[model samples]
Target: MSKTVTVEVGLGDRAYDILIGSGLIARAGETISARLPGTRVAIVTDENVAASHLEALKSGLESGGVAVAATIALPAGEKTKGFAFLQEVVDAVLGARLERRDAVVALGGGVIGDLAGFAAGIVRRGMDFVQIPTSLLAQVDSSVGGKTGINSARGKNLIGVFHQPKLVLADSGVLDTLPIREFRAGYAELAKYGLIDRPDFFAWLEKNWREVFEGGDARIEAIAEACRAKADVVARDEFETGDRALLNLGHTFGHALEAATAYDGARLVHGEGVAIGMVLAHRFSARLNLASPDDAVRVEAHLKAVGLPTRIADIPGEMPGADKLLDYITQDKKVSRGALTFILTRGIGQSFIAKDVPSSEVLAFLRDSLG
Candidate 1:
């Protein structure tokens, strides 16, 4: 069965849908054939995901009668979002001699989506692309938003565009094959919607987190609902010029932590970093009197309850250097004129962008993050 969650971007001609359901790949051809501009296609996936899901996707497309010109299996991880890898894809897209009207399909996690979407954004000035996110993080978060870019030596997702996908097909069953670590990591992003401005959602998460983590019926329903929530916000603020910024509740610090660790090669997964980042956001929110300490404590407690890191000491190697984190923050996309744009929460389900915060104060907080 399928659950449909449609989010109209309100850009008139630029609106889209984010379809969440089980066994979505079977409908991939139908989804693409219905929305995309051209029949020629390119599928970009990572090596890890390809091993498990690539054939099914390709077969699905063929069975759906859509012509797939090429399928590129990227090396999984944040590292693949760099120049050489992007060039390889560009070569493939161009070598295929695809037209601007031709579509690109992102077939893996956020990394693939960012890289492939960016390639599509630039190739022939732009091409439509579809997102078929295989990981939970991509499903509920990355896949829907048009924001796509790879990591730089400077920061995680620092080099990306506000480009949106043509269609997003998030099949919850895909999570079963995902590594447990990655599934747990994605949950951090999953919980973030609640952290940003959905108190009731967060409450639901707390009540059903264990079941959600287990990836069953409750998990599927909640994941679809969470995607709907995010899609609702994205549809309203496509460029993140307003409320969309709220999506980064833990991500501001989470991105910094991921950059500080260079994605840490299993040492610190993106979601784990966000888990810690949320704790820090809560701490800073409480520290700055924007949130109640009790609420902050509750956030931390919940993060820990789900086996997510909630403190600096929980990070590896003395929790990365404060200076390193500070440096990462410097390169953050939200930084401007030497002041940081932090997504600090007033409490669960309520976050606001705190701009003009001094680097010195942020550094001071990072210092405290070490313990």
Candidate 2:
């Protein structure tokens, strides 16, 4: 048995544990049953995840005496995080006659986690939620955050609620089944933790990212560390009211890019967009004299070394114009009262919130970036 590392998100009465390790899916029943006694559940997953992991999860829950009232498998991809899928999950969970005390288990990547969590939040005014995050991105980031929502036609994650999960199960073994591209996409998020405020973690990743990718202790440590970083921030700002917005390090521009591509996975997954956006964030900071150009270079180099796209130009397919991208940025959830708000950095581990940034400056930067 691979060792499991536990990180706690201390939210007082709403506190929860994130368990990271291997074979967690098989042992999930014992854990869930222990934490949420006599709870029935509805499993929400995508078709791809269902084919690969749904049965093992079902068996685990069954063995623990947890009843699965229904299993919902939706289409796979970024597009699945929408109203239609949210409705499908809610309808099924309700159709199963699941009461508020029952649980909703999300059994896929970030999309499923978000969609299922949103369903869990609104159905019967919120049911107990469990996150079984199969993708590296989901395991480290989305699964730990209580922020749940579907993407809007206007912006990413614009429609949702802050419904934290009762438990999170991150089984590294399932990552062996992920494509190299998908794995690389997830690594971008892992690196973001370092860039946010853990320069030492960033440096360690620079020296040991290959081993982290190879799997084993390195990957587990990295995941646990990322979760810990996020847990600390979440505990401090559960509603993203203050320091918590720092968590959106690259998301402002990253989400704009995602919206620009219409959330197309072929052109850009969330992590890849984030990869490019992080580099851009550093470069934009340097452009504003907030950080050194060397910082941008270093960030771009590390991300590129991990096989992530560090430039918007690297995205395949035609991209929208700078004006369109800026328009999308204006619509981002981070924008406060029509004033531009961004998480700009001064260098590694020196991020701060910058509000009232002029739209013209951003427009000029986007034009330069698009060129």
Candidate 3:
């Protein structure tokens, strides 16, 4: 039997539990039914995940005596988080006659979690939802936060809401089915926690990452640690009014890179983009004399060793110039009153929000980075 780790996100009445283990998906229905008895559920998933784990989820729900009101499987990929599919999910849930008290089950990775959570938030003015996040990325990062939304042509996650889930089941067993690239991508988010504040955790990962990949107690520990770190931050700042923003250590530049690639999974996945972005953030900080250049080199080396892209040139195909990339950065949600707010680091585990960053300085950095 695999070990089960539960991390709680404390938001008083809005609090929920994240269950991380090997077989949680097979047990998801019991967990949900216990917390939300007699509620019908609508399972929202992407085609890729549906092909692999949807039946297990349905069987689990049935075994737990929970009625599944509907199952909607949309096309998979980052592009799925958009206005069009958001409406499709909302329409599917409402069309199935799921009430406000019934639940929407997000049964995939970060994209499904965000899209379905958004649907649950809006359908009939808010319905309860459960996140059965199948991917390591969703299991560790996106599943814990209440933030949900789709991307826009302007920027990523520009249109979203704060909608917490009732419970999250992160099944490590499902990761066995993930492609190597996808799993590596998710590892970037897991490593980000260590970069943000837990230097010890980062060092631990550097030593035990192979064990983490091999799957065992180490993987569970890494996921639980990441979830615990995020849960603590979410408990303190649910709305990202302050400390929660630190969770987005690599996201600012990462999102811009996603936009530059038009969110193409072939060119760059979210985690890969984040890996590059994190290296950029550290390098940029060093350029500002806020951190040692060695810190940037160390960060880059770690991510590259993990097989993540750590530089702008690592992206495939032709990309727009630094100016065009900066245009997308201007549209990032982190912009506050026309000034950029970035999570800059003084060292490997010393990140802080740098507010009102000069656009001219950012432009110069981009130019240098692109060269």
CA-only RMSD, every prediction: 2.1, 1.4, 1.3
- For residues 1-371, could you state the per-residue lDDT of candidate 1 as single tens digits? 54554544344566677776678787788777777634778999999888988888888887877889988998888789998999999899999888888888899988898899999988988888888999998888888768888877755676767777767888777888877778878888888888887888888988998888776677777777777778778877887777787787777788777766666756788788788888889899888888899988888888788888877677676356778888877778876667778888778888888888777888888787674
* Candidate 2, superposed: residue stretches over 4 Å from native: none
**What's model 2's lDDT at 112?**
94
Q: What's the CA error at residue 228 for candidate 2, in Å?
A: 0.6
My TM-score estimates for the predictions, one after another, are 0.93, 0.96, 0.97
> lDDT tens string, model 2, 1-371?
76899999999999999999989999988999999999999999999999999999999999988999999999988788888788888999999999998999999999999999999999999999999999999998999979999987766788999999999999988998899999999999999989999999999999999988999888999999999999999999999889998988898899999888887788899899999999998999999999999999999999999899988899998998989999889888787778899989999878888989888998999889988
What shift in Å separates residue 296 of candidate 2 from its native position after superposition?
A: 0.9
How many clashes does each candidate structure show, in the order listed?
A: 4, 0, 0
Using lDDT as the measure, what is the rank order of every candidate, best first? 2, 3, 1
Q: After TM-score superposition, what is the CA distance of residue 299 in candidate 1 from its true location, in Å?
A: 1.1
